[model samples]
Target: MNFLDHPFNARAGDIIEVSLDKQANVRLLDEHNFSRFQRGASYRGHAEHARQSPVRLRVPGT
Candidate 1:
């Protein structure tokens, strides 16, 4: 029931940003905030029904 666990709240085509750190896990990234996921932690059940999220762009003119 947490923020990241609620896939219904996360819309497709939404902006998702991942850390540049080499050890970062895409699924571990927080969808409702700017933070990294903890090790061995799992997302809520909603993740299974979640839509395909795309990464947001920070490039110039974007």
Candidate 2:
């Protein structure tokens, strides 16, 4: 639903600065730590769950 061919109100190839939960399905724009996001990606600085996941699942999908 979010994968945009053409994002509304958002221009294509625009560098949209954003922060997200650790479970968000996204790839980092950097090169060092390369990992694929299945459910979603998270903001490393903001995602406490990424450091230590909850006993139960906190990720929305899985």
Candidate 3:
């Protein structure tokens, strides 16, 4: 997914949460980091099940 297409336009000093496979990954993208991400830089990190509530899984088609 393109960063520009992200619902929240996270600016410098802003943090955004990315959900993957029912796991939540939080990212803090500074100006440089944000630029790199926008330019397709690969981000390597670990995600954990931090949410207390269950996340509803949705398929593309029912």
Candidate 4:
């Protein structure tokens, strides 16, 4: 499923899981604090479960 087209319904502080094919690299970002913006962790080849923050997910280089 393409999450960009059909995103899951979630609210703040909810825990969400993301799964990726072994070759995918995803960069997760916390956009909640733009003034003190800090990048979240990067993951590849596995699934990750984390609390939902104001975030954006992308491949490393557009």
The lDDT per prediction is 0.33, 0.30, 0.42, 0.36
Q: Alpha-carbon error at 52 in model 2, in Å? A: 14
Better structure of 1 and 3 per TM-score: 3
Q: Which stretches of candidate 2 lie over 4 Å from their true place?
A: 1-8, 27-62
Cα deviation in Å at residue 54, candidate 3? 13
Candidate 1 lDDT by residue in tens digits, 1-62: 13333232334444445334233223423443333233334443112222333434222221
Best by lDDT: 3
- Backbone clashes counted, model 2: 7
For candidate 3, lDDT tens digit of each residue in 1-62? 52223434433434344454443533444456556766788753323344633433221121
The Cα RMSD in angstroms, rounded to one decimal, for candidate 1 relative to the true structure is 11.4
Task: Please give the ranking of all candidate structures by lDDT, highest first, separated by commas.
Answer: 3, 4, 1, 2
- Give the per-residue lDDT digits (tens) of candidate 2, residues 1-62: 45312122333343444344444443222222222222355333112223322222222221
CA shift at 58, candidate 1, in angstroms? 14
TM-scores of all predicted structures = 0.24, 0.21, 0.32, 0.29
Lowest lDDT block of 10, candidate 2: 53-62
Task: Give the Å shift of residue 19 in candidate 1.
Answer: 1.7
Q: Any runs in candidate 3 off by more than 4 Å, and if so which? A: 2-23, 42-62
Choose 1 or 2, whichever is better by lDDT: 1
Evaluation by TM-score, superior candidate among 1 and 2: 1
Scored by lDDT, model 4 comes in at 0.36
